[model samples]
Target chain A: MNTNLYDYAYELEKAMRSSDEFKHLQEMYKSVTNDSEASQMFDEFRNVQMQLQQKQMQGYDITEDEVMRAQEIANRAQENEKVTMLMEAEQRMSMTITELNKIIMKPLDDLYGSMA
Target chain B: MNTNLYDYAYELEKAMRSSDEFKHLQEMYKSVTNDSEASQMFDEFRNVQMQLQQKQMQGYDITEDEVMRAQEIANRAQENEKVTMLMEAEQRMSMTITELNKIIMKPLDDLYGSMA
Candidate 1:
């Protein structure tokens, strides 16, 4: 088989690393980490978020109280300047990834539509 | 800003193209296209699937009858040898893309914990 696909994968990886969104994400990450309070808040928020996801993925029902608490923590974290910046950067990176996925999957999409 | 992310995206595209799953998908696509009957069946299947997706995306509820009809078409299409090969190939390709997406999104995953 040809090595073209692997080569493209490597190139795509490089591009993602150099993208503005990724760079901004890294920068915001450093900024947030430099602030002890912001870092702690972000960490707590992340923990709560992960637990919720794990529960959902495991097919466990999350209580309304748990959901509310998680949202509250996220809201508090967002109030922090560093956390807000980090989130925006993260969103940009996410959008970039979504766009790239669409481009990369075009062939499959054209051939199979949304069936896959 | 750095261009790393875009570069990575390109590399990833290359890798996906060169992957066995992708190559097989292409080959299967070619085989199905060469057979008129299979190609027609596949085209119809794709059309139905796309229509359903569009409706769902538009927030329209798909009636039970529509769902059953779509499933029937899919079942009939799968019975064709060429269509079956194409579907299998597509499944492999979809799996490969999913895996690649996971790998590419690791950093974001760790940082945001699925919040993004």
Candidate 2:
């Protein structure tokens, strides 16, 4: 077929962004970033998240101390009203991305069978 | 709107999988894995790739020695006929994914503007 996979993927993304879910997410994100305190809290929370994700990806075990520290920062970040709303929006987007990833990874699954 | 973005995404995935690009990729992958020598070489190349990516993501700079070592491994991996075909397939897929990501991140781009 002459169809380009990238073209289809682009259309899919356009459809996703046009949804209410994406609009709400963008609004919530704007609200969060507009507040300086909330923005700082978000930055700190994201730094911890990146560090933890990096450690996990490298196949390293996360220390209990690091986990506790991350939890503390996360709890603080979640305590803010705007941050909480932003997180709800983020959660929905995260699920959508997960679904998209499953779709994208089908070829590998087909190739590796149960191993994938 | 009552439309679920997920449904559209799934339809798009169906379209992608049916494209010649995906078919050729699958065929190339099958040919590569079917050859034991090529499979071993591919595995080695992927391991090095993983290590270098992990290092880079952790904010570590690649030393001259590490770059040379990776290049050597990649050269050997590219020399195999089936592996070369698989790499071509993977490159096309990579470009497709990059386009998809750009679309998916539009909300963030709108929020962060130039910083994004």
The most accurate candidate by lDDT is 2
Tens-digit per-residue lDDT, B63-112, candidate 2? 99999999999999999988888889888876766666776666557655
Task: Give the top-scoring candidate (TM-score).
Answer: 2
lDDT of 1 by residue, B41-62 (tens): 8988988999998876555678
TM-score against truth, every candidate: 0.65, 0.70
Quote the lDDT for B28 in model 1. 88
**Candidate 2 residue-wise lDDT, A1-116, digit = tens:** 33566666667767776878777888887787789999889888888999999887665778999999999999999899888898898898777778777876676577657322
Error of 2 at B53 (Å): 5.9
- lDDT, residue A10, candidate 1: 48
Report the TM-score measured on chain A for model 2: 0.80
Question: Candidate 2, what DockQ?
Answer: 0.30
**What's the C-alpha lDDT at position A20 in model 2?**
81
DockQ of each: 0.25, 0.30
At residue A103, give the lDDT of candidate 2. Answer: 76
